[model samples]
Target: MSTPTLPCPGCPGRRNHGQYLCRTCWRSLPADTRGRLTRRDKRAVLRLQQLQQALAARTPLQIIRVSP
Candidate 1:
């Protein structure tokens, strides 16, 4: 099974625990998160995309396994 998403800006943090953060970054989020996306975070997201694209570029596109 996969981890649930961290809390989103969808509602208040006190209501639901962090079930809206992207699964990969769940550990980075706080239990009581600040909903606003800060400037550094925006830049970091761009950097994350660049890092993802860089990693993805070297991999073959075709898949070998199927999920049920």
Candidate 2:
């Protein structure tokens, strides 16, 4: 006897769909891996880190316009 389960949102994981992703899908996520990033994932992470560093190094820009 087992409880009813639903199809995973990300993939067809045969588990309960209480969350957005099932356990299998969650485990398969690239971000969840430990020190084993693929080349593409690593590049993406590095790019994001660079963007964050650049943002932190500069002041935010603001624009104001008035019309009469």
Candidate 3:
């Protein structure tokens, strides 16, 4: 049996073992800045980078909620 693979959060690709991102996504991540980063901080940085890319590719929309 082969190891179970998961879909990449950034792209439609399989994530590698023990990693949240696939090879392509991993390579696409922005370079780290000059500072100390905890594990949680690192994850947050990566997540934000992914979100920036995803948001940049689409048009923005405004939504309004109405209540009675």
Candidate 4:
């Protein structure tokens, strides 16, 4: 029978510990520092795309609302 494998990738040059890691470093990152995209960033990109789409459709609307 095969043994139950853990998440710890015990590979050479790998860092981290625990079954979810290797055998060196650990996952000690902030909840928000995990390259999480901000809502404002998403909104800005979406707004830009909407603008481009409207321009392509030749029906652009001028609407700007400041968010607190």
Candidate 5:
């Protein structure tokens, strides 16, 4: 079975259902932000919110940051 995909939140590309951005857009994000987003701890939801807010504000991918 293949994973379902949807339009990426960060770009016009498609991404896996559970992913936040397409591969290219995800890679464009800073390493620290990537690490924080991947950590499924108590702050995970907040981190996702931060990302969404940044995207909504049209922040550049390379400088986007989420809470640690």
Candidate 6:
């Protein structure tokens, strides 16, 4: 079985199911931001919200930051 892919919220690329961003966009995110987003704690949802807000505001991926 293969994972279903959908359009990435961050860019025009496609991302696999259960992933937040496509490979290109994911790799473009800062290491700290990626780490925070990958964490599955209570604050994980908040971190995802922060990422979405940044993307909506057209913030650059390199400088995007989420609360840790």
If scored against the real structure, what TM-score would every candidate get? 0.26, 0.31, 0.43, 0.28, 0.92, 0.92
Q: Which model is ahead, 1 or 6, in terms of lDDT?
A: 6
lDDT of 5: 0.93
Whole-model lDDT per candidate: 0.33, 0.40, 0.46, 0.34, 0.93, 0.92
- Please give, for residues 11-42, the per-residue lDDT of candidate 4 as tens digits: 23443322232323123322242122123574
- List where candidate 1 sits over 4 angstroms from the true fold: 1-40, 59-68
The lowest-lDDT stretch of 10 consecutive residues in candidate 1 is 59-68
Candidate 3, residues 1-68, lDDT tens digits: the string is: 44539976656678766665566655554434211111455365665454445535632211111111
Better of 3 and 5 by lDDT: 5
**Residue-wise C-alpha lDDT for candidate 2, range 5-52, written one tens digit per residue:** 876444455555343335664455445231222235536556434433
lDDT string, candidate 5, 5-57, tens digits: 79898988888877888889999999999999999999999999999999999
lDDT value, candidate 3, whole model: 0.46
Off-target runs (Cα >4 Å) in candidate 6 are 1-4
Better of 1 and 4 by lDDT: 4
Query: lDDT score of model 1?
Result: 0.33
Residue 40 C-alpha lDDT in model 1? 46
Off by over 4 Å in 2: 1-4, 32-68
- Looking at model 4, the pairs that clash are 8-19, 16-24, 16-25
Local accuracy of candidate 6 as per-residue lDDT tens digits, 1-68: 45647999889878898899988999999999999999999999999999999999999999999999
Q: Which residue pairs in model 5 clash with each other?
A: none
Q: lDDT, candidate 5, residue 57?
A: 99
Measured with C-alpha atoms, the lDDT of residue 57 in candidate 1 is 60
Pick the lDDT winner. Answer: 5
